[model samples]
Target: MNAPAASSHLLPAVAPRPVPQVLLDALSARFGPKQYSVAQAVREQHGRDESSFDVPPPVAVVFAESTEDVADAVRLAAAHAVPVIPFGSGSSLEGHLLAVQGGISLDVSRMNRLLRLDADDLTVTVQPGLTRKQLNEQIKDSGLFFPIDPGADASLGGMVATRASGTNAVRYGTMRENVLALEVVTASGETLRTGTRARKSSAGYDLTRLIVGSEGTLAVVTEVTLRLYPLPEAVSAAVCSFPSIEAAVRTTIQTIQMGVPIARCELIDVNTVRMVNRHSNLTLPESPMLLMEFHGSPTGVAEQAGTVQEIAADHGGKGFEWATTPEERTRLWTARHNAYFAAVQSRPGCRAVATDTCVPISRLADCLLDSVQEADASGIPYFLVGHVGDGNFHFGYLIDPNSAEERATAEALSDALVARALALEGTCTGEHGIGLHKMGFLVDEAGAGGVEMMRTLKRALDPLNILNPGKIFVL
Candidate 1:
């Protein structure tokens, strides 16, 4: 069964909600003139992300420098009952950071400061503006690293907001496991801290978990303390091809089930492979392939990878080649990380709808097979790539934004995939949070009661419903 779209949808404001002259004066007094931008040029720039959804620009844009700045911005917006959308890197695919309500877009990109690094504790404190790449570069020489690699160079705040996990999730786990604590500013302009930097916790309430995936719906993340891992001693990577996707997926299931402790096991369908090939200037065969990576002592990693190769052989996987050189491994991952862009560029003048689902390892084979069948039969354009180690895969569908028929067809395919995922005891969304794109499908996946509970929490934390209004649950 499918859930209906929003009832009586109200269009979002194109400009910031009309503010009184007196309030504007107050804002100018609180911060310098350059700190706030009410002009159309600024509002329009911060309003939209890479979402396929309509770009309803924010009413105003604020360059917040500190936690106090965020608090003041949220307070002022709430006073006028205006939405305060937190803007990060603007690379969100799910309409996560879009300013649909047209209020103040509080951009923290300027707060790119690395505060502290406790090598002993294996944790780092950073501002919301710090991107993962920047953070790692700052701490690389220290021999410690943050491992939640979301492919996109998304901001730590944005990643935490969306609960993002990427290629390394199968090895190091998702943002849920990496974020040790968060400093957030509530909708009421009050600041509070959630979680501690402790390695383990049996806390009364896991507020960290609540805010991590809340997608800026409850509070604005100002700072974060994240768990880190020591640099791996040894690493090995390879790109191996298979005659078919089923063979690749089956081999992945076996490798994981046999407990090879693989670090990365990503499945790239042949169509995606073709895209990557053209984009990267490689001449790989147009066959499904699995990108494998292992990290450990040299002997241990080599032995484990060989065992996985044997498992692949059993499933008829071939073309396994070692990317043993650091340069080769980096090049391989760089291509893989650019898969989404490559898929989009494969068809110019189109937007990509990246819909993904997760299934139990037991049913992963059948679930992936079903997805392949649906894509082939629907006449819709989609290519598959995923962290098969965790039974999570992303289906990229490049659709023309202008055609109603195309949009409808693509949407129908998304619904079908979501249904299939739920049927296989998986989730409608694996890593991406429920933003504007997936709200319509939430009822089918999480049920009305589950959604209501989500709304209840949103209302409890943000009674005014100003922080990212109309994001997750039906408001």
Candidate 2:
């Protein structure tokens, strides 16, 4: 959907609430003292995320080792009318982990088990705590792999909660497309199963999709069934340098328009290239560049690379670097994945306020170039990178976290970029789900009617508002 202009600012400050002693005692009794913690440090650690939004930590943290544990935590939270926030790897760029309403953090990281792996069916069922990397490692011998990579080794549960997509999304699609089924715990602690192992289903309301991107506001996902892909017969990686951001983006648009089955097409601006060079210990040319990957038979990969090389040359692209060996391929993509940290370390002690705007493929050039120009004009230390094949990109604006003026400047630039993207019929956030930071923008993206309908569903499923309250929308 084309997101409307972002209208909301930062989340309104919420006062902290005390956890009822009786509820805490009950929790301790139910799950032993070791499974639950109310220590100050633990609560503080669970309260923040990779984002800048700050809120007090949950009054307690419960380590859930099984689906029944999750259900029980939710049931207890509901009984006390307290909020329940699900915790994963804590790598979320938005404040999806913040305990805004003061409740218990039901951490599922302990439930990291690969329950079922059906190689013939190309499907796998896993408990919520397993990270994508771990899952890939365990399944590597099966000749299959999970393709949705959000750069960070994020947990599957967290990825589902945010509806994450990564560099591979140009070909593999996002979590919204890849997740086959879900086991979720409702606000009232009911275990609800959505979808089946079958590839297609007209079973009912697509509750799987509904809970996939709910940001843990609707239900806490306990288990996930994922679609897997066979390891490609042949893989090739390439890097092409362009004269300018516009040229690189134009090349991307034309490649997609020509229906090239490029697996990964990423745009790294000159500044980001410089950062990656320093961070990754590779001396790549400092210019706007596109790093890409192709998967197929040897002949197919060669044909695809030749086609993209011609397209790149037409746009004045230089230096078509290819990685032939497995080690080379890993090094190349690892550098690309570390772009975020590279951008962060570029400015010592500066926190990054990033933008996530995606425009239609046709308008990608205009939208990207305009946003880059704005970031340049702001004089904020920033880095740019994009999944250009899909018309999605990001700008990491580095600023002093303590300086309110700098923070506001970065936010203003982000807001302006979102406004421009919306005007171009794009979305305010393409991959990063709306947590605390983009709650206001949700209204613009989803009209009053759409949001009200969502509210109606939330009320129907969670009458007590116990699941991740004050997240996607105010209740």
Candidate 3:
């Protein structure tokens, strides 16, 4: 399995990056008559996402409306040696949606629909296209909620595919813990469903997990069955201010060390505070803060809240603003969710370059210090935030996209961060899956034997190399 050669059709001319007619024909054959149009608008719309890079636009974009459509599209792609790129809400930050290899961009947006909500069982089945916000909207009156909130109202399928985690992951866990089943269309146009509704399974080979984080490389997720929860009896949040980054990190480490069960524990540096204040349109004082949340029976939440307050006090922390009202809690998370954009927005016209690294809980303090040091040494204007409870942090570098040197400097810092995480015996990626952006570093992190096994699985599943070609490996 070798990487596909760069398409010669991508000549730098007036009609640059010509779409392959063979792929267009395949789409028409698989999709039946006049439903799919070969219009330029479709191709332009599916070109790229929020990533800080550029690439060729997909040759065509098929609006997949059902699992059958996804399977057919994959078959068409396989037959023509065309790469298949699955797309959801186009919210990916890592170029996961970019058509690096020219092919049909399978847009799953049209498939958005809620199929089931078994409240008594505390589970839900949904089409991959339904956004998180959309799902909650449909189930708001049902007294059940999906807790894997990845900030953006990103598609549930997209979130699961990326193995995303956000503000609530500290208490609720990532998509890895919330997702129960998946209906997938494999590389060869074969459709299969994995995972049962059972609370837990010791079943053979954990296929559900394999597809959950595959990033559409192994399969296109058309449907997802998720583990839901009874709406918590009570939810409350407070923001605690710290004088220094070390103080903030120390508070976080100690809180987790004490096992406080805080549902959302995050570290926002003073630098990010300025950005949040401006971008959130609020006048929060410029300082390092630990934003937190608790979920349980009212009395239990209260006890957990008191435990956290005591722990933070020992670490020189202050600024306790309890967001007890629903509106207050919404406002708090809204600020946190927009942290990425806030960092980018601070520097007008600049792009946010983010790198994710997760270290062992015991090594979090050292990892934080090293990240700040390396980032400072590189002299990139950056903001730091994290799911500190899980020792996963993100360093977002703001760069002027037009300046090549500045971009290179940011990329160098990013590479250093991944190396540092690997050196600390942690993963280069914790939540965000190893999409194309992390593939090269994943090899370094995964080592030779690990990558070889990955290649073996790639060959076993996608022998033609038609599904997301050149991803996760050079081979």
Evaluated with TM-score, which candidate comes out highest? Answer: 2
**Residue range 1-475, candidate 1, lDDT tens digits:** 2323531112333444565666566666787777887888777778767667876677667899999999998888788788888988888877776766556688999988999899999999999999999999999999888888777899999999989998888889999999999999999999999999998889799999999999999899999999999888898998888988888988888888888889898989988889988988988778899988998899999898999988888888887878888898988776578788888898888887777788898889888887788778767677789989998888877889898777676776677777778878888788877787777567777888888999889879888888988677646
The backbone clash count of each candidate, in order, is 2, 0, 0
TM-score of 1: 0.94
Which candidate do you rate higher for lDDT, 2 or 3?
A: 2
Q: Which pairs clash in model 2?
A: none
* lDDT by residue (tens digit), candidate 3, 226-291: 888778899999998887878888888888888888888888888888888888787776888888
Highest lDDT: give the candidate number: 2
What's the lDDT for residue 29 in model 1? Answer: 74
Candidate-wise lDDT, in order? 0.83, 0.89, 0.80
What's the distance in Å from true for residue 198, model 2?
Answer: 0.3
Q: Which regions of candidate 3 fall more than 4 Å away from where they truly are?
A: 1-22, 29-41
- For model 1, name the residue pairs that clash: 15-59, 16-59
Give the poorly placed runs of model 2, Cα more than 4 Å off: 1-7
Model 3 local distance difference test score: 0.80
TM-score of 2: 0.97
| Residue-level error in angstroms, candidate 1, position 15 | 12
